[model samples]
Target: MTTLTYKADHHWRFSPILWGALVVAAVAVYLIFQDGVHLMVRWWQRDEYSHGYLIPLIALYLIWQRSDVLSRIRFDGSWVGPAIITLGLVVGLVGELATIYTVVQYAFLIVLYGAALSLVGPTAFRIIAIPMLILFFMIPLPGFLYNNLSSQLQLISSEIGVAVIRLFGISVYLEGNVIDLGGYRLQVVEACSGLRYLFPLMTLGFIVAYFYRAPLWKRLVIFVSTAPITVLMNSFRIGVIGVTVEYFGEEAAEGFLHDFEGWVVFMACFGVLFVEMWLLLRITGDKRPLSEVFAIDSPQKAQENEDTSARHLPTPFLSSVALLIVAVFGAASLAERQEIIPEREEFVTLPKELGGWRGRVEIMEQIYLDTLKLTDYRIINYTTDTEFVNFYSAYYDSQRKGASIHSPKTCLPGDGWRFNEIETHAVDGVTMGGKPLIVNRVLMTKGDRRQLVYYWFQGRSRIITNEYAAKWFIFWDALFNNRTDGALVRLVTPIREGADAAVADERLQEFTKELSKVLPEYIPG
Candidate 1:
């Protein structure tokens, strides 16, 4: 009896003091990461990130399922916990300074990891580590990455969807991301990019892989197969919509039918995952029933004779909590620091006529306005005797939040344009900051239509051609200059049918020279 009692006492159990400390730590974490958490929740409202709402609950469930194993381990806190917590705090500070909430969101996860390690030490932490890592699925990708991914997925889905349509003995033409089916045209927009299914199915696959009783390689296959499964299933759904629309008119692709098709495809993806698992099991010579192969054992109950002594709070955990409290104060201080928005002329004041070119201003639709979230913008078509150029500029007073300039490289591809060549070119006659103007020069095509384009990012007296460099400057300026103001200046000209592309290039360069002189007034150095 004495030996049994001693063995039971060796096992760690949460006491009232520990529970109270956990509650305090939770509150501190909330206070420190409230802004990022709120933004994450807001992102959950979008279809692609809607699965975020379930990730936390699933993570908790995973931990709860392992409680039996957790209860057997002793809580010997390690100094590594405090070190990790310090690292997390430093990362959070950088995020706060840069005003990038995505960085702060990741830092929150890092701090939680440290806090968990501080409380339970390395032994028990290993048991719960995967579940903790799973929490990362809840955060949304950065806007630029998401746009680029969505564009690629859109193009893939469109091509596959058109192929599926052709397999049905129906004629279809594919140009970039658009599917032209004689009577009707279908543009594979961002919503149809398969990401909505990809994210949720990937999360589900990860959880399934954790529970699956199989060889390591087989479990990995189950998880990784989710991507191709989602893409193929989503493409099939699109193809089915096209076939239906061909017979039943445009109504087949709108309202309830379109949404119902999405649901069906997502369900089909799940079915495919299960089928793949079964195949893998067969290949491995496992003849056990599918139900038995995927085990989710109930947590074991504690013995009545176990020790019930109250455990003291660990010093590492207390230190972690103290660090979080300090972070709360730091975050509050950051919130008090207001960003500076410099005075600049609105795009409406931009000159219409310049350098012997006549211009016509164009109004963007409400959908684009909402998506761009620009403070001001100007879109105009400038024409000469035998040449024409399209000019567009977007400005943001503050890019601290998610609303930043969208790169033309990403946006153009989504609009059914394929990039043929991309390079940096310096306009000889045009200058910025007493240097030759350098811009991202691109030759893109959609079917037979070819266009020559030039664009660059202007911010904080810096002219940047690289998208990543622009982002770095935004972070740098936000931290030191207390400003995130920026603008995207783009010029485009169509290469007339059977004409040399060089003429269009010359037209854009000439127009760029004149436009550069006037842009400083609106975009500001």
Candidate 2:
């Protein structure tokens, strides 16, 4: 028996050409990590939370996959490595200066590719690059995509929640984002609209894909599951909140549970994911693990085959210095976006789908959008330098159905106090279970005068559920806080600002366009 002893006689051959890749990779990580904060900040400006827990996880996963290759490759004292490092660093600096996340993203990718090419060679680089790039999905979507998704989820949530509640023998109705139960009414606020879960779902999807090494079929199944999971769980959540009022009284579901219960729904979603994995495994008994099927484990064999096949090129890497210049300019551009936004109006050009809702709005007001999905609306004028928030108090009293009976608060900016105003008007709106979208607007007053308005421009699909509370929780804050202080635009209006009152609508329109995303309805149709 030839005793295959461990190699004491073999020398680790380090390629100076390739060893340079590590420096390039390091510089890449630094640039990405730093810009990551700014990019995330932009997301936050658009009301999206940025989480960083997944980056290290993805990095580790990649490194682990390449451990076999790394074990044999050597680090020779090579100027080539330093040169690559310097090039990557220069690119990173350029990207940073440009403030362009895309440039940053591109720079990061180039560094990754360059490093992988130098260190691991062609076959290994090809095998690793795609999975590594897929990791980009872990980052939160930009504001535009998030807003679009929120609308879709809002429409879907409203329809589903209304259906579920009605089936449970509850007399429920919906309009736009609002839901009406026997003694309970809710407007599916931002938290209930599914934004919170959407990002996590995206992250979860990526993780599931990575860990399962799933085939397209398996991955698709996993991806598809997020929809029903979000919808049904949200429905159940809504039902729970509705029933909680019946059993524990309305106030019981009002505070923390109303806001934090979304985490519970999210956890419940995980159970569904796990079960799906189990089912997939059970279904594929005796078949290949997805990783094996996708040749995830075949890097060594792949490298050997490709080398023998001679189907790859070994061209020397060109200087990425030129690309680095482009990245720098791009970074500078991103920095420009960091500047403060200008003031604007609140009334968005409601799309035709939501246009009919302009007339259909019966009562528009801001609510916590928590346990109770609906509330009366109100409009508060802050410009009055009165002793007792007079403009808002009277505004609240007048629009009894439209205004929420709450103190001054804010959701936007300036020294604002948020207030709710409900306005009722009849108009066409998409409806399920006999609930129609209503029209209305509420203003958050700042320093007792200027206002950031909250208008439910279209109320065609108010669906309510507790599971989606996370998405709408932030919305509740905006309502209760009255588009609260921090960063925002403000316009002072008279105490009786309303549609028929001939209020100057331009400023408010500017606010919404500049501050908030597109109206939750208005799906481009």
Best by lDDT: 1
Per-residue error for 172 in candidate 1, Å, reads 1.2
RMSD of each: 2.5, 15.1
> Can you give the lDDT of residue 341 in candidate 2?
19
TM-score for each model: 0.95, 0.51
CA deviation > 4 Å runs, candidate 1 = 1-11, 255-262, 433-435
lDDT of prediction 1: 0.85
**Which lDDT values do the candidates have, in the order given?**
0.85, 0.44
TM-score of 2: 0.51
Count clashing residue pairs per candidate. 0, 91
lDDT of 2 by residue, 1-525 (tens): 011211222223435543454355355355444565455445443222443455546656766676555433332122243355456555654544433343345455556556445444444445466556654654454322444555556656767767766666767666555676667776566667766665576567656765666667787788777767767777667666665655676787575346745567778887788777767876888365534533444223223322221111123332343333444455555544432212322233322121111211122333443311222222233221221111111111111111221212212211224354434322233332244433234554433343333333222123222212312432343333222111111223444333332243443333333222443322111
Question: Clashing residue pairs in candidate 1, if any?
Answer: none
lDDT of 2: 0.44
